[model samples]
Target: EAATATATAAAGDDGGGAWRVVGGDASADGGESPTRGDASRLSRAVDVWSLGCVLYGVLDADEHPYGSWFEREVNVINGKRNLDRIKHLPEAHALITALIEEAPTARPSAVEALEHPFFWPDARRLQFIQEVSDRLDKITVDNPMLDSLEGRSSAVFGHRGWQVVLKPSLLEDAGKHRYYRPHSVRDLLRLIRNKRHHYRELAKPLQLELGDNAGAFYRYFAHPSRFPGLLMAVYAFATEYLAHEPLFAGYLGPETARRYAADAKERCASAGASEEDMLAAEEAARAAALLSGDTLQETRREWFPREDAWGDAARFSVSSAAAAREAAGALGSAAGLPPVGGPAGAAAA
Candidate 1:
């Protein structure tokens, strides 16, 4: 056990305090695994607690609020933590409380933490999206009170009173990265899916009532490919937010930011983006990064594969073993492969 140790030197003490990194007399198992109260074992809950502690340090100027290593042991034994000390982020206080909650079952998962409102204003943004999306069907009005300037009519999405849907449905506030970024993809996707089916069936007939904006939304998202504009908007929002987030902000100096920006532009171009769109996104990201503090320093990173490669940004459900086996079996039959238990198929070979 690399981090296991016992405090046998102290009377009434058992296997704990791994920072000591040495087991003591009359101690076994050390503290290599985690324990809470009477229960002791390896667990993701234990890791979540550790993550909370590490985050507590990162957000608090690398200072451990638990005093010393020995002090933390005392706190754990008493089932208490100093989570309230992270006052700089009032929006995150509830999150910090939840992370260090004494009950193991009460703790939230990593994905939950990433999706939490503490990181971004998810509810507000979603509400804003819904409000504007609903208004798209109101039929772009020309303010009948005003004088007619020319033969042109004001239905935005289409040419006539029946058509409000624009050709390239231009969003009103797309450039405002601060207001539009989505902290939670799950939340955004949920809102989009929830609205898609109802609006799809009602789009044409309802465009008579709702107008062209609703028609535009329905037409764009009704397909199997889903709405690329909304998807790209969410992706762009994340990129902009991450670039300017307090933890990562200003960590990339201009030169390094430029290099990263160029790398991103190249990647975007490879992903079938026009050179112009690529440059636009790159510039936006770079500008966002520069808006924060200076003095470049490395930002924190998660361990393992995420450390070596890009973090798994796209969430997906896990595949089951049975599903894998069934698929493989079907593929083998199509390929005319030997069946299982065929004695290595010597004659066929």
Candidate 2:
């Protein structure tokens, strides 16, 4: 009887048994599977897939990832996993998805899998951000890496930028730094980079002040869900700017960084070195004109003949006091409050 059964199995006859072994070369969705002799299919990636299935089962009430037993083998072969139940858990979902990628070569190694953001602590995440910021400080403005960082930061944090998202007190403290500039995300990162670089060299009193002020900054990252893109953006920024392999590439994917690099290269090729120099010269000229109070209606037309007229706009000035008053007035107006020195403001105070 045993010899007869073995011969029947070898002849592809399961006899309707519920526990029959499914061959690895099972096809699904009319797609061809790897031949039985293909040794490339047998790899650590198989273990990664198994690990993913186990994790999915553990997270989803011990249920099989591919479905019922009868369909499980087919679904696994087709790379059709039912992750609906655990989809709400972004980090876990991401890790599992990468682990079970259809292409065996696409799956992360065991060590890379362990480094996923899903496994990171809040402290480590913060440290990661600090390290990236430090690395970015060494990059020049002309580097495409800064452009990539700026683009990603804008997408994650918004065009209003990181300054607006941070606490008012923290912003104020940042302004006091020698390298302070509130114009862009690059400026904010540079400020942090400079402060952090000299932090240990500072006096104890200054160090404590810096730490106390940065408490809210740290708290900002404590609840990442509130800022969904914060960690991913930082990770992407690091991957591109620091020339480091992505730690959370499985989450955000490495395609974005590659696309940015490609786009940057294309733009440079199309613009050529002479065009870039000309553009830079024009920008410097505009800045010089604005600072020299030469952007008045008549002067602007004279200096930048192709540019539009200021059209009765107020004269542009670099006067600090005037800029402060203008900013204060704008804030007061937006809040429906009177100017700072007015009777209504005094009474409200």
Predicted model with the maximum lDDT: 2
Q: List the residue pairs that clash in candidate 2.
A: none
Error of 2 at 324 (Å): 38
- Could you tell me which 10 consecutive residues in candidate 2 have the lowest summed lDDT? 306-315
Residue 47: error of model 2 in Å? 2.2
Tens digits of per-residue lDDT for model 2, 255-303: 5334344543454334332223334434433433433232223333432
The candidate that wins on TM-score is 2
Give lDDT per model, in order.
Answer: 0.36, 0.50
RMSD in angstroms, candidate 1? 24.2
- What digit string (tens of lDDT, one per residue) describes model 1 on residues 1-349? 1012111211123535442211112223444433353233224545565666666666775455444565655555455556556643534555666665565556666665664445644334343344323322121123111111111122111133211222222212222222221332232333343444344444354334323454455434322233323422332322232222222223323332332354444443343332343243344333323322221111112111232121111111114323322332343444464332232222212
Q: What is candidate 2's local distance difference test score?
A: 0.50
